[model samples]
Target: MSSKARHSLDPLNLDRFNHEALIPLVSPLTGKNYIGWCNHIELLLTATVKLDFITGKCERPTERAKAEQWDLVDSMVRSLILGSVSKEIAQHFIHAKTAKSLWEEIKGRYGSHGPLLYRIHRKLRSIRQGNADLFEYYSKLCNLWSELHYLKPIPVCKCKCNVGKEISVGECNGCILAKQIADDKSETELFQFLMGLNDCYDNVRDLILLMEPLPTPSKAYSMLLGVETMRELSKGEKGCEKTHDLVCSYCKKIGHTHEGCFKLHPKTKRSM
Candidate 1:
């Protein structure tokens, strides 16, 4: 009678299911990785169309034949749950006959940590670039942002909203205000990223913020990357020019000076 009822009747789904090859190497649920494991396993279940099993959205049928098929599908999803977590966690939930029960039990045991949320927020606020390169620093911020977002999902209404659709920049005239609001939300991250950047990039950071329309975080990254590349190229060219001016009075070599002539002092060199 339901979508799962029809979907469970298909033996091809079970026959084609390959758990070993499909399981990602995510952290175990027993560790401090409930978020990562939860997100990863949900994606796998969603892709396989078995998400309903754990979500408890589908009811069991009254007919024995249909109920048996439902149990078979539930068993498959249960196996997926067991395989993802640590052996201890798997053993603890061994008696949870249904996938939904197992999933809820696991969530109850580990998902509601108040300290983790606070810790993540503190880490985000205190994050600094330090000695890490731009790419590395940006990647760290992105990873934290992703986890933070997962914990507190952004609320956006897509119903009859043009901004929710794939309408290009100017084409989104109707939802211009909506789009601007969404864009404004991301400015927090952009400002945070810019603040964490090395002070040497103060000029470029100011230049980026001065743009009329304002740039997205990624656009800012590219602009700063261009400036960084130019600075590196300039330094390299200066180093090359200084190297080219070297000349040895002893060996008459362009690369070595008289005091640093290898021929004059075989074991030790000097530069004039």
Candidate 2:
């Protein structure tokens, strides 16, 4: 006989068969009969296991079905609870909420420095003043804040004019420009006076170019040569004689010269 024929009659293999494996063997049987057999086998095995575990009083098939259904429902509930707890733990570290709180947290972690605090203060001040353009004020504030931090004091350059008497540090450019524009002065005198000021060479050149009646090429060339020569002469122990002589004769100051004068110190009366 064939192996299939032998197995069909073999009760040992059929008794050990599970529902999945029994399907192939029972394929020749009607679907209703196969399903009845599966249900009967499952109920008998479940009852026998339960009876062994308990006092030989097996649980009914209806009770076993209810218990299995309840177990699936309990597992689903447990999975949902664990998923919620994991989400909550993740949210504790990664906040998807407002940026303000996050920024504060970062600032707290890394100590806020002077420059950063000054920038924030300036921004707040600009907001309070209703000046929406914060960038315009930022550069000025930063420059001043840095100077203050470094303890580098700015020098005040005095102007001969009455209006420029109350000069403050960082006002040299404007003072020279103003002196150059007034129609009363000659171009040569203005150029020479500007050279005497502590303003940078570029600033002097720019101011000269911006004058109402722009200086002639000859005047510009002369001014350039004069500034270069003065720069060279001032480097050594002795100062430029031409520049020193002009300042000494014309400048109101006695001990020093106009180039060194903060302002026209009050003219001293001669004592008899």
Candidate 3:
């Protein structure tokens, strides 16, 4: 028996399922801002699918009795999809008869186009790690790289060449295409990452570039991280030294002197 067969026999109440519990508030897509909205809708739809609810193309039910059940589940799924969206975004798909139609309608209206790609690249080009956490900076770049990757999926190797050898004697279209695209992307991302680093990392960055074979982005990140970690450790050590150097005349504490000691004058206005 299928999993759906068991699910149908011991049916949970779909009506009792709180659709709003996990669904995020998807901001209305003004054509430009829809990727995140689409992601939210996809997750919600996947949840419904797991519950044996169909959200795809409107298919006719084999039995007359099942038609009614289909319509009810379809409506529920559609409502879940539309509820998270704004009125403006919802209005465009108001006429869609099925959940699938509604989903496709929204994707067709906002998912494609050059403007979105242009904006993504523009943001990538302008990103800077100034006064920001290094991990956060790397993560932001990685997210943008992921978004770009989704736009253009990585090609896979299909040729049956020497599988274990370093050089494939017969590199097919898939392998060549994948390698070319990966090389270009890696170079571009490395340059972007290097550009975003602060002046403090200039010497280290230059050294990486001057190497016999320049390091990969991941390697560059490791080198930068090592520098950042050491810098933070040095700063912490200096802070500890400063703390130890302090001497309060009241209780002789390491953090404060007599003028800043709260114990020296507990009731005085100058007490800290």
Taking all chains together, each candidate's TM-score versus the true structure is 0.72, 0.17, 0.65
Which candidate should be chosen as best, given lDDT against the real structure? 1
Q: How close is candidate 3 to the true structure, as a TM-score?
A: 0.65
- Which pairs clash (backbone N, Cα, C closer than 3 Å) in model 1? 259-270, 259-271, 259-272, 260-270, 260-271
Name the candidate, 1 or 2, with the larger lDDT value.
1
Full-model lDDT for every candidate? 0.72, 0.37, 0.65
lDDT of 1: 0.72
38: Cα error in model 3, Å: 1.5
- Could you give candidate 3's per-residue lDDT for residues 1-272 as a string of tens digits? 99766664432325434566644545555555577666666665555442344344446478877777777767776777777677777787787887777777877777785766787899898999876777888988887777777676665565776365433334777667667777777888888899987666665667677765667788889876765555455456421222223345467433345665677777665532
Collision pairs in model 2: none
The C-alpha stretches of model 3 lying farther than 4 A from their native spots are 1-18, 25-32, 47-58, 157-171, 211-216, 237-272
Q: Tens digit of lDDT per residue, candidate 1, span 15-119?
A: 546665555555667757788789998888777677778888766778998888888878878887888889977888899979999999998888875766887
Question: What is the alpha-carbon lDDT for the whole of candidate 3?
Answer: 0.65
lDDT of 1 at 224: 70
Q: State each candidate's clash count.
A: 5, 0, 0
Write one digit per residue (lDDT tens) for candidate 2, span 173-236: 8565544443233453344433433333344456466766877534654654564455556555
Residue 271 C-alpha lDDT in model 1: 38
Model 1 regions more than 4 Å off: 1-12, 162-181, 237-272
